[model samples]
Target: MHGWRIPASVWKWLILLMAGGLAVLVASELHVGLGARLPDGEGSLRVTLEDQLGARPQGLGTHWLTVAALDPRSPLAAAGVRPGERLRFDRPLDRWRRFAPGERVDVTLDSGRSLRLTALPTPVGLADRTDYIGRTLIVFPALLFTLAIGWHQPAQRAYRSLSMMFLAMSAAFFYSFWFGAADGPSALGKLVQLPLNCLAWYFAADFALHYAAQHTGHLRHWLAHAMRFYRPLALASAAYTAWFALGHEAPWLWVPSTLSIGGGALILFLSLVDGWRSGRGDLRQRYRWLVLGLMCGGVPPLLTMLPWLDWETGLGRITVLAYFGGQFLTYCLLGYAVMRYRVFDFYLAVNRVVVFGVVSLLLLCTFGMLQHWVAHHVSAGHSGFGWQLLSDAAPAVLVFLVFNKLHARVEHAVHAVVFRRWAAREAQLREWLAAIVHIRSSDTLVAGLAAALDRFGDHAGSAVYLRLPDGGFALAASATGRFPPRIGPNDPLAVLLRADLAPTRHQLPQDAGVLALPMCHRAQLHGIVLLGARPNGESWRPDEITLLADTASQAGLGLQALRVDELQQAVGSLHAQVRRRSVELQAAAGRRRFGMDALP
Candidate 1:
């Protein structure tokens, strides 16, 4: 039997199926691993509240805290502790020196209800400091990458969608780092984290589906089609999760988060696998790199989701390092893929992002360290507000000056490294064309054209010869050397150029030589360009020849336009003269009529 050929569209489903299987397998392993690692239920009770326990300001203070919920089976619940009921202590809860587990606590609710219960250990832990650090490292680069892609390749729908996904993830990470700290109020932290958590997974899946459909051309597949609804679904899920967290104080929001995360991962996996299987040569290689990148950056972060892994655990630190390091490597690999394949023309953008990010980060860190040292070691007395302002401004001003000086150099280096030679040639062509459009004077236009050609470095000498009204080609502009004053209409080279209306090589007497490019618009020969040997003394490449021909055509059009404008001006002047003559004749006729009438 011959090898089977899968249609490109089928890859989407295949990837999804495979990804689902892989997710299931991973989830099962994680479940087993977590079960083995998690301690038996500590003396804590899980609870959901029907309504939020509102906070009230203490006497002469703005600080707020509340018994937000109560476990249904807990000792407090047996004593009539309920949601939305404010706790009243005999002395302020804050005033209590210490309360150990099993200590009796008594409180009256706002509704005059009374309760007495034993204190119990709550299943809460301090947020790890390393978690914040790792998240910052991951998110800063991700944000920069997203911004670069969005800014540079907005037209590419896939990239835009991917950027949004990254933005969502970054926001989630930021929220976790900022609000999920141990010092933050537990109820408020959970409220802020809920929607962001949902959004992160939703956008991740959404990005995967979009990536698959766009890059793999798998939109026709049913799964890809179904993914069309994923965005709306994700939004609804996030909204619901937020509402539930705020209103009911429920932990069930994890259901939607899990579904989104699992679905997205599955789709991404399927898409990648399908792309690798179906792609040919360079495309296949690109998919391989992308897969490796995703695995490196993506897997470690996912592993951190295991309930058993806290920041204090050795495995947690390993996962954090892996996550950050993997993501950095992934971005590098993706940037390489972009450069090699010209994906969304992102090479220059990637270079700019990397340079700016690294430089800015270094500058900020150095300034921070210096400020800290100065604050502790240099400042001996209390500095006033003005002095403080100066201290802050100094570092900012220094950084700005240093960045301004280095930015141009960095940009130049980046362009030189990232852009190909042809891109430079194209840029030169555009400059020449722009000059031709903007310069209206015939002399200036011709001079700029010759200068532009010389700057291209393809020719040692160049000249523009425009057709004069006297039926001869007059030298309008010359670069680097003198040229003949005029060429007769019947000259052999001129005849050939005019007839062909194209570039042609001509040999002059005395072994002097040139390439003649006819400048023609609408079959009318406007001018000719006589180009000398290349600066390198080599024959012109085909692309260079094409460039010359195109430029010559444009020059011809510019000449034609100039001639048209001159003719219009002359015609206007002639019309003005004719009007004056007609007025004078009419005045004389009136005088003659008046004289004839008087004589009679």
Candidate 2:
């Protein structure tokens, strides 16, 4: 049993490289043109078509294009081919037909109008470019996050399931983008690639259920057993979809595929409910965000998949954009949970995300309003290249001028609201922290911490527990009569504080009112701080909790320094004793040699 591990930083770079290469390949395969419209000329016509044939003339097949718009100067316009008219070809209009520019073709309209014209090239439009770019944005981050999870915590079964789900979704995005970008249906691309794309979704659904179940620790045995049959069902559905895509009509495949997706969604919802009901504190909070993220990421895409929605049309394109945006938000939240909540100990990640989001929104809104005002007043009717350049550059300049100040104000506001107490007394807290670090004895360090806590707020009592060599927590300092003399290493409160280094409220034996804060450094439990109820007997506020945690961390550092100093002193004393012993032995040997000489 052998395995290899790669650092997360390296994994990130590799994922970026892979994404860049894939982007380049997809771009190369894409057909570039002036726009979605035909060339503006006498012979050329600008025609828009209804994407669905059912919305057009009854006799027209799905391949027949229904004209939604026609340019006045076009030859087709001269021939009285108007909007609401439908055009049909001798053969089915597929990707191959759509891309072959300048080919002469026979066309018949629904009104019995017929004309011979060269097929206009289907130019890629702004909407098309936006869709492809959006998908790329979504896929890149999602892939990076997935790889990071797998590389950083490969042993975690929940993360492995999540990685697989993300991988399948990424592959599906790639295939969809690849075929969608092609000028025509490259037979190999459409047949083989399309089915594989559809197959990816089934795999994604299965993995999503597995991920949720594993994460919530619910329905473990049943879900694991069900998974054995689910794999075969997923594969069969993919094969059936593939067969159906290859000119075979089978409606039955749709039933199982739909059921699979629906079931996965149900499983996830149930898991969330179970987790929310069974979990506490951070676990509960995590489940809430997971639900939100999944909904934001998954529901929009499902809505867009409604049969009546024509995804190639303008409205459909907007829906797709929304879907991609939702997916991006979803992935961001999920990544934050997995990285910050599950694996990493950094609490500031959430704060940073919030700050960044708020600042970005403010900047965007400000920039947009300024640009609009500038364009209206300064650049109206001045459509020269220089004027256009100035219009484009003004917002950026304005943003640069004000962004730093705005960012600072926004961050300050967020901290003030989120950590009100800490923000208010940060300077004082810093001064105390500095004084605590300079203390060189355990008793002094504990006494200083207790005094600092008292100065910070009105606590009924306070005590500091220093960790003994044998792993017990002994009360080194306390406010005259605040706490007991000692708490054993195996005490419930001691064990809980040691296991989770977060500051939490705990009742001592017989319901003693105390808040226990774990003093830890780099995840090693060093000691515990017990503080009695506030003077007014109020609940602990966020800022107060935050202050306690911060103080505990500082106290841990002070205790560590004290321990190091004690060890250094012991070593010096041992060295001195060894020197004295060496001198006494030398003197004794000299006396023995003198006595022997006298006897001779």
Candidate 3:
């Protein structure tokens, strides 16, 4: 409560400001680092990641790869080079991306002719720039996700912990790739890395604690205990880093780095595992991608950073790529998951993801084939750049023409296979909608309406309220006991429903987790359907809201029609009794005359 604290109202803005500052500093550092590594000599080498990994027609694992690309005028080429030849480097593919200009890289060819390949002392090469861009792309999106999720649910523990985790992770990755210094990792970056990683470690636990359906508490208590241990170490580490930066001989800070990487990663992984074990179906699904991300992103660092294992880069391109690949994929997937959490979950999140992906791939492949055909068959006579452009444009135009229908067909086909289990639930929902039309009884209509909503397993509870003779709506049927018994004519829910006859959102709130939709027919509010909270704590998706609204509309009409039918039957019965009474009276009139006559 003492040192410095921003008010809750402006906390999101504070985070944004911090992000901006960090981005500026990172950009400047990257620019300087890239400039420092600029090639200073005219010498050149044309090796890419694929070239360094080697060109093999067939083999397995590390045995399949490792070859150096040699430009005709380059030193490696001048020495000796041949087709289908292999070579080995001192470092893996990742390290190759960070090679400093004028650095002589030692290699051994398949022919046993060992040589040192002098990396051209020139500007940042295409491969290096590409690597930097790719890693940055991966980090920034995850970072942005943190801001997004936090902004939406600022009070939630998951948002704060998740945001901090990615922030630290992004910073750590920046240090990994850019290193800040041309010669090696910057002293400043190294100085901050320890504490940032430690912070990440603690936040990982914080996320674990809060990611459940219930949060630990509403306040930020993440650093309560961890800060006590982290502070003095941070001060000492800062002093040591400054000392080392001044060219003094200081002991390398392996202790803190090792502890942070190992401790933080383990804590994250174990927490996720614990949650998975404790949670149910959809809740468990939230952890799978995160655990995978951790496994893929965590293992390499543990194996590499720990003093015991002493992991090295000689484990082949595949291993190295997988290491980086894991981080990239993990972050990308999380970014997607966090950003689209509420907007895109129905059936199975993963299934829909696959459906979209497969459809997109099919479209791309077809378009590519069309382009290839046009390039080879239609572009033979094309000479000018404009003509070539026209040839390529033809395929694009054709693809665009067919894109919508083709995408729909492909998407539907993919969904049919991918979402086989969910398909039945969808069919059941449609069947429920259809079944409502024939429901003639008022009691049956409202009961059936509640059951229809209950069929889809999202809401915790559901209720159907029908308009009474006095103009108030009373709960006619409920799948669960959460809803109120009656909504009076002057009740806010009733007032709003009367005004608009539409669905209510969280704005005009009553009880928690309740979404009220009006059942309207001929512009009159016939009934109201209230759906309780989702069990997983997520908002109702668009498709779900659409389904509920459609159900409410049809149910309203059916209820209105049933009421009309009952009124018609009552009137018809009254008419039949009146006619029968009249007939009896006419017969009695003749009998009464006979009785009078008899009495005289």
- Residue-level lDDT of model 1, residues 185-204, one tens digit each, is 32243344457555655545
The C-alpha TM-scores of every prediction are: 0.43, 0.56, 0.55
Per-candidate RMSD vs. true structure?
A: 19.4, 11.5, 11.1
Q: In model 2, what lDDT does residue 466 have?
A: 78
Cα lDDT computed for each candidate against the true fold:
0.56, 0.58, 0.58
Over the full model, what C-alpha lDDT does candidate 1 score relative to the true structure? 0.56
The numbered model that scores best in TM-score is 2
Ranking by TM-score: 2, 3, 1
True-structure RMSD for candidate 3: 11.1
Clashing pairs in 1: 15-270
At residue 146, candidate 1 shows an lDDT of 61
Better of 1 and 3 by TM-score: 3
Give a tens-digit lDDT track for model 2, residues 264-350: 566556655566566544455666767777778767766555646645666336457768779878865765454334422224554
> CA shift at 45, candidate 2, in angstroms?
10
